[model samples]
Target: MTMNAALIRAILRIIGASLVSLVFVTIAVFFITAVLPGDVADALLGQAATPDAVAALRHSLNLDKPVLVRFVIWVNGLLHGDFGVSLISRRPVLAMASERLIHSLLLAGVTALFAVPVALVLGTASAIFRNTLFDRAVSLLTLCVVSVPEFLVATLAVFIFSVQLHLLPSLASISDIHSIGSFLASFSMPVTTLACVIVGQMSRMTRAVMIDALGSSWVEMAVLKGASPAHIILRHVIPNVIAPLFNVIALSLSYLLGGVVIVESVFHYPGIASLMVDSVAARDIPLVQICALIFCAAYLFLTTLADIVALLSSQRRHAA
Candidate 1:
């Protein structure tokens, strides 16, 4: 098959799988929330409320319906972009979820903007330097940062950056990313905390992968042919490892997503992960399901995109 056709086919397959998995994810999120101990009705009514009042409330909320029926209703609503109401808050789920999702997306975006190119450069430098002082220092620094828990890192960052130097705020809560100063003021701590682990891991992994690529026969031949170091590394080394690098980048992005939960809580950032924690604590079933579904969807989307990119890289290698 032609490389283009193969690449296109792989892209479609990955997207199709993502969609199917998202469907199952939604159903699973709903049922798992169903099995949790506390009932939305109970939480809404309170412990002192009458049994009759709770039953009426359950019926009103349609919690009295069979699981299948409720799931069907939810799916229908979801198709129409309605995510039901938060039992604990009585607010629209979609409204709250969308707002928080945007926040999380923004955090992820800023983290990526700072993390990716820096990681690539660090990885390249570490690989080229090997066991030299620069390489050892990079390795030690990354290992130390990676070993630290995000919450601890966040606390230390706040203490040093905010409390000590007063260079950044501890808690990030500004609403406008469009305002440059405000955006930096709000996100500096959380983004630094959130991106650190991912950056560390990616840089180390990329270095390892690129080092192996650079050590290969083809790279050695290119070097013997008097190819420029930059040309050989960029064209011969990186391209050979591009597929694995894509996977590493995708996994790092996923790490950033998962770490958002911890970092958001530490920084009191208003994002989907924070909302998910609150919803779970309150046994807010609708909101919990919404948040979980979103988390699943976002992860699936990232991995699928990674797969597509890797597939294209593979096809290109084959064609070459």
Candidate 2:
């Protein structure tokens, strides 16, 4: 196939994969949510409530329907952008989730903005200075950060920044300030916590990719031709490392989306993770299903993008 045709085909494949992934996620979450051992009525009203009240609440919520019928209705609602109501709050789940989703996305963006370049610089420097003290020190620090659990990092950040130094608030609260500053202040802790993890993983991947690229045949030839180290890295090393870096970035993006639940909860940041947790606790089946499907779609899209980039890179290298 022509190069353009090949690229189009690849894009189509990725879209198809993402759709399949969304379907699977919807099915899995539906069954899991359906099987959870709690009645929405019981969750809303205490267990000591009268039997008539429980039965009436169940009927009102359509929990009296067969599981298959309920799942069908839930899926239909999801396709139409309705995420049902929260049993506890009596609010539309999608409406409630929307307010927090923006916060989480902003926090992730801030963390990535700070983390990615720092990781690339540190990783490239360490790779250049491999076996030296600087390399060793960077390696050790990356390992330490990676080994620490996210919650521990969140707690330590709270202790040092919020509790002791008082640089930022312990809990994020929406305020009357300008939107830009208010968002920055509200999400500072969650952003910082996520940045720590992002930096560690990205640094490790970057170091490995750069080290390998720098040691490749083209780099050796550039050095033998009396090219400056800076020129060699900029011209050869960076291009060679782009494919792997793309993969690393995609993986990190997926992690940021799906892996921040604990960190979000620990820091009390009102993000999608927190929403999912609350929905699960209340057995809000529709909310849980929607969140799971959205997350899965995101992950699948990222993975597919990575695959396409890797494919194009490989094709270019082969043509060269």
Candidate 3:
């Protein structure tokens, strides 16, 4: 097949796989939430709830229906863009999740803005200076950072920045963000915690790709021909490694969708992850299902986009 046709076929395959994965995620989320302990009625009514009252609430919410039947109904609703009503609050799930989703997106965006550039620069510099003090230091730092769990990093950030230094607030409250300074203060800890991990991962992956690019035969030929390191990197190494770097960045950023759950919980951030935690605690299966599915869909979308980008880049490289 022509390279263009091959690339198009690969992109179509990625899209199809992503759609299948999303459907499986929806089923898994619905079933997993369905099996969790406790009932929404019990959570909402607390000690005041009697058996009869609980039964009536379940019936009203259609919780009395069979699990498979409920799954089918939920899937049908999803196809129509209906997330159903929140079991506890009786509000539309979409209405409740939309704002929280935006908050999560904002957090991810801010983290990306800070992390991506730093990762790229550090990765490139480390690759160029491979095995030197700077590269060794960076490698050690990333290793240590990656070894630590995100929650620990988050806790240490709160302890050091908020508790000890008193520079930033521990809670990332949106209501507290009125001015630019306040906005920075509110986001500083969570953003730092997230960026710490993402930067470590992206930089490591980028460094590996760049090192491989630098070690290529053309790069060696450039060195033999008296090319400067800067010229070799800018003109040869970077272009060759751009596709892999894109994949690394996309994969690393995809973690934010899932990893933000811990960070959001720690900071009491009013984001979709926090909302999902609350819904799960309340046994709000529908809301939990929707939230989980959203995260899965986003993750799949990013990976699929990265695959398409890498495929197109390969075609261009071949044509060149």
Candidate 4:
């Protein structure tokens, strides 16, 4: 198929997949929340409420309705862009989630900014020096970083940088920063910690892809033609390596979005992951469901984008 036609088809498929994922997220949230031990009414009202007040609260929140009905209502509200209400703060769920989502996205964005280029450069360098001391050292470092738990990294960062050195604040507070420098200073530790984790995974993926790409026929031919190593890598190997790296990038993006819960909580960063944890702990069903749906949508969208890019790259290579 033509590239334009292929692109259109891919876009359609992505939209369809996103819709399906949304439905699945809704069902998953419904089932997960329904099976939890506490009564939603009691969880909201607490032990001080009388039995009659509890029943009244349940009725008000529509917890008295059938499970199916509750799910439908929630889904319908979501369709209308309402993410329900937060039980703890008595605020609109979307508003609360939006605030936290922005912080999380900012942190993730900054982390990626620091991670992607560093990983690519190191990976390429290691590939160029494969089986040598440099390659071994890079590989060992990647493995060590990947093996360490994120929580430990965060804790060590807080201890050394914040407590011992007094360079950055120990607590994750964004509110006190009135200037950009201060904001970045406050954000540096968490971003650096997250970036370490990202670099570990991405560098490994890049190195593997580079190694495979270096073995391809084009690379060998370029080398045989007396092309400089730099020319061969930049002109030949990098383009070929991109298709495989796209998948790795997509996976890392999804991981950053959904898997940062532990790190966020560890550092007390007010990101979506932390918000989701707090919401769950508070039994804020609406907030939890909304966050889950957003995360699922993001994952589906990024993965689909990667698939499309990989397909297009492969097609272009074939055409060439």
Candidate 5:
């Protein structure tokens, strides 16, 4: 088949697989959440609530329905952009989630905006200076950072920056940001912690890719032709490695959604992951489920987009 047809077919397959994966994600999220300990009604009304009151509250929240039935209802509502009501607050789940999601997006987006470029530059530099002190230092730094958990990173950041240095706030609350300086101080730690994880992963993967590319016969041929290192890398190596680099980037950034949970919890940031933690504690099933699904959907979307880009890039390279 032609390259165009093959690329189209591959993209369609990726999207179809993503949709199927989303269906399973929904099922798993629903069943797992349904079986979580503690009743929503009991949590909302307290342990002292009468059985009749609990039953009435459950019936009102439609929690009294069969698990499968409730799943179907929830899925149907989800199809219509209705995430149902927050059992504790009596607010729409979508509205509550959207507010927190925006915070998360800001955190992750800002993290990516800085992380990607820094990672690419560091990785390329390390690869170019392979076996030198700079390469060893970059490798060691990434390894150490990768070995450390985000919560630890965040905790150390707080202790040093907030407690010892008194340069930044420990908490990343949005309400405290009254000016640009406050905004930076408020967000700096959380963003740094996240960037540490992302940059470590992306840079290591990028370094490996760049090293392999640099060792290729074509790269050697370019070197023998007296091409400048910059021209060879920027014109040839980067073009060839773009697909793999894009995949590394997408995967690293996808970790932001998962890692943000720990960062949010440690920093007391008002993001969806922390909201999910609260919802679980309050037994707000709808809110918890929606938050989980949003994370899953984002992961799938990034991976699917990466697949498409990789396919197109591969096809273009082959055509060239």
Candidate 6:
């Protein structure tokens, strides 16, 4: 097939898959949030509210509606970008989530800043020195990092950095973006904790993919041609591995997006995951649903972008 035709086919497939995933994601978020124990009315009313008042509030919120009807209404609003109001806060769910979403994006962005370069270097080095002490050491260290839970890692960081060294705050109070220094200071630990986990996983994936590519006969030919190590890596090695690395990066983006709840909770980072957790605990279904839907959308966006980039690169290679 021609390169353009192949690229178009890939794009069509991705779009179809994304649309199906969106439908299922919306249904799953709605129904799963619906099934959580305890009523929103009860949670909001507290011990002071009369049973009659609870019933009235539920009616006002249309909790009295049938499940299908409520789901339909929510889906309709979602289609139009109307995320509804929080049950507890009485504010637009998206409005509340938007602020937290920025914070999360910042955190994730900073994490990627530390993670990707460090991971690439380590992975490349491990591949270059395969089976030697350096490679074995990287394997063991990453395995240990992977084996431990994120919360444990965060806790250890707090003790060592906050308790023992008194260097940084355990809890992140990163509210103002204008104050870049303070924001970085407050968020340093959370970012570090996330980076540790992310680097390990990304580096391992890079190493695995690069190892196979390096072992291919073409790499031997490049070496026999008297290509400099840098020339061989840049001209031959990287282009070959870029497609698979894109897949790895897409997965890493998803993890950085929504998988930081443990780290956020530990450091008190005011991010989207933090908002989701609080909303869940407070039984605020609208906020929870909005937060979750945003995460789903973001994951889809990153994956689609990665796939497009990989396919375009593949097309260029085919054209060549």
TM-score of each: 0.92, 0.91, 0.96, 0.94, 0.97, 0.95
State candidate 5's TM-score: 0.97
Candidate closer to the true structure by lDDT (higher is better), 1 or 3: 3
Q: Rate the local accuracy (lDDT) of all candidates.
A: 0.88, 0.82, 0.90, 0.84, 0.92, 0.88
lDDT of 6: 0.88
The alpha-carbon lDDT assigned to residue 291 of candidate 4 equals 85
1-320 per-residue lDDT for model 4 (tens digits): 57778777876887787778778777987789877777877887788989999999888998898988988887788779777888788899888888999988988888888888998899889888999999999999999998988889989998899889998887677787799888888788888888887888998888889999999999999999999999998899988868788888888878787557877898788889999999888888888887887788888888878887887887778888
User: Is candidate 3 or 4 superior in TM-score?
Assistant: 3
Candidate 5: deviation at residue 20, Å?
Answer: 1.0
Question: Tens digit of lDDT per residue, candidate 6, span 136-187?
Answer: 9999998898788888989999999999999988888875445767777787
Tens digit of per-residue lDDT, candidate 3, span 259-316: 8999999999999999999988777877887788788888998899998888888888
> Alpha-carbon error at 41 in model 3, in Å?
2.7
* Model 4 lowest lDDT segment of ten: 253-262
Q: Considering every candidate listed, which one attains the maximal TM-score?
A: 5
Q: Give the per-residue lDDT digits (tens) of candidate 1, residues 203-312.
A: 99999888888889999999899999999987888778888898888889988778999998989899999999998988888898888888888789889988888888
Give the winner by lDDT.
Answer: 5
Evaluate model 4: give its TM-score: 0.94
Give the C-alpha miss distance for residue 88 in model 3, angstroms. 1.9
How many clashes does the backbone of model 5 have? 0
- The 10 consecutive residues of candidate 3 with the worst lDDT sum are 1-10
Clashes of 1: 0
